[model samples]
Target: MASQSLAKIIANQQLNSKDYRLLISAPQIAKEAQVGQFLHLQCKEGIDPLLRRPFSIHDYDRQQGEVAILYRVLGKGTKQLLERRPGQEIDVLGPLGNGFDLTNTADKVVLVAGGIGVAPLVPLAKELIELDKEVAFLLGAANELELLCMGELEQLPLQLKVATIDGSLGHQGYVTELLEELLADSYGQVFACGPEAMLAAVQEITLKAGVEAQLSLEKRMGCGTGACLSCVCKVKVQQGSGFEYQRVCSEGPVFRADEVIFDE
Candidate 1:
């Protein structure tokens, strides 16, 4: 049901020296996007970069026909994207991939984010709040300067906590340290988007806590679609100890924590 389109840029803001946010007009994508879905944004015109970069759905307004992506400038592709200005059009394909399932989830939810991975969890928090659930957000980064979306995140009604490796702000540690405290207080469900090491830590911790956790994984992608195996991750077999590869782009950017088999 999804198709490629040239989305008109409504606004583009440099959140920091490294991060950027773009609000584009894509009615179909905005209407269909869910909490953890993503957009495949073309970096620049033609095939200069050769492939579209994947950005998680940061925010959207169906009524306004708007969608936003929060991204970090990591390389050639995103570097070119920074040159784009408002009123320009960008090629995009989206509302792609499965998102978190909120079915019969706990009333107390915790969201864990590491660095730029926090993008998708912002929308999930909004959805959880709208469902009348209590949400506690834990964000971790290298330092306060690296934190993205803190202003928007703080505006939400849910509880917010922060951690940094350098102690530049908030708690002087990883967000997982924060996650443990909230979970100990009877918080039941967890949704996390972060780096592999942090996600592995989360998986280990939540497993011991005996609470359910879902992880939104990040992998390099050549195609945001499953046609290429560029973004595959190993997931444990439902009936056995063996694991199978699944595409992060199509099958998930989200998966149950226990179902994943982390690399040693």
Candidate 2:
């Protein structure tokens, strides 16, 4: 169990039109964070926005005692998070959920990100590199205007690819199109995050290619650590033919991609 707290915000900045980055000094939680794990942030003030907003742990500098959240303003809670200023205190609970698994001895690894889904992968990529894995990352956005945090990704030891729906950037179609091209080559495994539709497409491609995959699901969460059962996603059992629902906050925000049944 982790200590819950009203941590003081150390920094908040707009990253782009729909997204922002917040840095909070949650000392105890930061100490236990792993890649793909998330934080359930309680809005400052009241229960009108009662449920905590789940944000992926973008990065954690344990030595600095800070955790970062890169979030998109999709609704009221997120909007409030975006408006928060430095020094504001907000309640938080986590390092919740199972994160990406990075144990493969595979020489080549592919990571795909779509829109704000890129948040959780940043730290995962860093960890892959530390293990000396060859990492290739593919990122997609609606257009150049909505793109976020390319600079930080580019700084990593990753062979990066970018795509825009309007052709303003790397590829002119969905990121999956680029992924299809990469599949013709030899790669160890694939990891991805994005809209459910996009994740579904990645699921389809990886399944056909016979490539192993892991997916991070995005869902609305309430209790954030399984008690509420609010963030349930249907996933296949790792060993069985039947399916079951797993709490995204606990069994995963991350899961073996093959184990998830993406259709609603």
On TM-score, the candidate that comes out on top is 1
Candidate 1 least-lDDT 10 residues: 43-52
After superposition, which runs of candidate 1 have C-alpha atoms over 4 Å from their true positions?
none
Worst 10 residues of 2 by lDDT: 43-52
Give the Å error, residue 55, model 2: 0.5
TM-score of each: 0.97, 0.95
Query: Evaluated with lDDT, which candidate comes out highest?
Result: 1
Pairs of colliding residues, candidate 2: none
lDDT of 1 at 237: 92
Score each candidate by Cα lDDT.
0.91, 0.86
Model 1 TM: 0.97
lDDT of 1 by residue, 173-223 (tens): 888999888888999999999889999999988999999999999888877
